[model samples]
Target chain A: MRFGVVVFPGSNCDRDCYHVIKEVMEEPVEYIWHKEKSLSGFDALILPGGFSYGDYLRTGAIARFSPIMPAVMDFAQAGGLVLGICNGFQILLEAGLLPGAMLRNSSLKFICQPVFLKIQRNDTPFSNKFKSMQVVKIPIAHGEGNYYCDPRTLQEMKDNGQILFTYCSADGEETMEYNPNGSLANIAGIMNGKGNVLGMMPHPERYSEDILGGRDGFNIFASMINWLKGVG
Target chain B: MLKANIYVTLKNGVLDPQGEAVKKSLKILDFGQVNQVRIGKFIEVWLESRDQAAAIKELEEMSDKLLANPVIEDYRVEIVEVNQS
Candidate 1:
């Protein structure tokens, strides 16, 4: 399956995603610039992490208005797989492709460290490779990773199984202390109701290689690739 | 030209960590009367239209579409000045 990694202005993780798809995952991938309007040949899209448009106004706020976003939104609506990481997730939230919004990290600091994420579900295209309630170590670097949604929307997401991964202890316990960003319900990732679009604040590409200190994130890409290949 | 000043503030229920930090600092400075502090954005926009109603409508549309996220923010627009050259 061909993957397209979107490259927005100020996006620094596009190359990392490209490398993971090409070198690590052995998949055909291309970088799509933010000005490009067509997404005809891509089977999947990855909106990689970085401070797009310098995080001005708000994180991902200006980037959502980029020329390529409407096409990305259309691609997602057509049941195409779209994975948004970090600032990419913020863009998805701003574009209304996903529900909720991100707030400044509770500590008001840009946290860059590995944190434990509990796989809330293993049935979706993004997390199918993870065992049920599996805890994976992934690094998050951001100032606005605190996810927030109205109580009603949170309840609806909970009922619809939209929540995919959440911050937790290494032993897989969801507690306030383990909630690194003060995200509501410790949410670190979520999928839309249709399950075609997934957004998470952690950088899976950064840890997809064992040489990078951990390969716990490799399964996320593996899961997506397997699902696309009809193996899952 | 119409100069529009837009104020974007987080919704009442949403938490504001920056404002909370400022409040804490103020409390430490012995400013005991400050009960709450909420930080928001102030943006200035220049519009070519001179019609007040139309400019207000356009500014509202701009706020709804881009300037503020309705999910967590509430915005207000004021046509602060009208300039003619």
Candidate 2:
């Protein structure tokens, strides 16, 4: 699989995501600057986490208007896979590629730590490698990770199984203690209606290697690779 | 000239943690009358065109595309035209 990682002005995770896809997953990876308008050569896209545009005017607000969003939109519309992590998730929300909005953490502080996530749906392209309700450990670092959506849309997501992941205890139990940002329904990640676009607050790239503490996140990237291989 | 006032907020059912924190602070300050508080953003836009329909269309596009995330926030556009002497 040829993965393309989007690099914005303040994207700090571009290299980490590239390293994981290229080295860990052994897939071809390329960097596409935010100013670029085309994504013809890549099969999948990854919007890495970072403080894009310094997180001014709200997280992901400024970066949404970057030049490359049109191409991202096109790629998503074409049924190609796209993953947005952390601020990239916020940008996806701002860009309307995914539902819900990110708000200030319930604790009102920047949280940085390893978090446990429960796989809610394994049918989507992002989580097909895991079984339903499986637990994975990943790091989450953000100030605006609280996810919010309308009641109707929330119901719709639940009915359609669009929710892909949720915060959970290390043992895979759902509890308020595992809710780092107090996200509604303890949501940690979600997929678009078509299930091709995924936005999550956790840093999967940070955990792709065992030396980084764990290799649970590798399953997600590996799932993407398997999906691409199937398509090709 | 046409002006528009836009109010953006988190949709109902979504927790407003910031507003909750502010309400708690107000209570600690002895302002107990505050029953509930919801945080939102108010934006005023000025348009050079006097065509109300055109301005409204542009504003709607702006709101739908960038001014607000429709999934979580609903925006209302109110246009007021300045009377010329």
Candidate 3:
């Protein structure tokens, strides 16, 4: 499958995502410029992490108006696979592709650390390789990743199994002590109701290799490949 | 010419971590009368249109579309200046 990693003005992790797909996964990957309107040949799209547009006004606000966003919205609406990581996740929320908004961390400081995540559901395309309730360690780096949504929307996502990953203890116990950003309900990741788009604050690409301290994130990429193959 | 001063703030029920930090600092200084402190963004936009009504409508659209996030924020716009020139 062909993968396209989007490069917004301030995006710094596009190369990391591209490397993971090309070198680690041995898949064809290309960098999609933010100004490009066409997503013609890509099988899946990735919005990597970084402070896009200098994170001005808001983290992802300015990047949402990029020329490529309308195309992204159309692609997602058509049920194409799209994964957003960190700042990319912020953009997805700003674009209304995923529900909720991101706010400053409760501590009011940038946090960069590995945190345990409890897989809430494995049926979705993003987590299909993980066992139910499995605990995986992945690093989160951001200043404003506190996710929030209305109670009604939260309930609906819960009902639909749209809530994918939640911050948890190494033992897979959900609690505030492990939540680095004080995200709503300790949510680390969520998927759209249609299950095509996923936005998560963790940097899976950063941990896709064992030399980077962990390979727990490799399965996320593998799951996508598996899902795509199944669909095809 | 018209200048619109817009204030964008978190909606009710959303926690303001930055404001909370400021409140803590204020408490350390012992002002004590402060019950709450919420921080928000103030944006000034200059419009070339002299028609106040039309300018206000355009400002509202700008706020709704880009200046403010309607999901978690509320924005108020005021025409602070109407240049006769």
lDDT of 2 by residue, A1-232 (tens): 5899999999999999999999899889999999998778789999999999999857898899999999999999999999999989999988889987888899998999999999987776887788878988999999999898877889999998889999999898888888999898899999999999999999999998878899889999988887887831
Q: Which of the CAPRI classes, incorrect, acceptable, medium or high, describes model 2?
A: medium
Cα-based lDDT at residue A83, candidate 1 = 98
Worst 10-residue lDDT window for candidate 3 chain A reads A223-232
Kindly report which residue pairs in candidate 2 clash with one another. none
2 or 3, greater by lDDT: 3
The deviation in Å at residue A3 for candidate 2 is: 0.8
Tens digit of per-residue lDDT, candidate 3, span B5-64: 999999999999999999999999998998799999999999888988898899999998
Q: Write the per-residue lDDT of candidate 1 for residues A75-175, one digit (tens) a residue.
A: 99999999999999999999999999999999999999999999988988998899989999999999999999999999999999999999999999999
Per residue, candidate 1 scores C-alpha lDDT tens digits across B1-85 of 9999999999999999999999999999999999999999999999889899999999999999999999999999999888877
Second chain TM-score, each model: 0.95, 0.87, 0.96
Candidate 3 A-chain TM? 0.98
Tens digit of lDDT per residue, candidate 3, span A62-109? 999999999999999999999999999999999999999999999999
- Evaluate all candidate structures by whole-model CA lDDT and list the values in order: 0.95, 0.89, 0.93
Better of 1 and 2 by TM-score: 1
lDDT of 2 by residue, B1-85 (tens): 7788888876775677788889999999999999789988888999888888898899999888777776667788888656442
Task: Flag regions of model 3 displaced more than 4 Å.
Answer: none
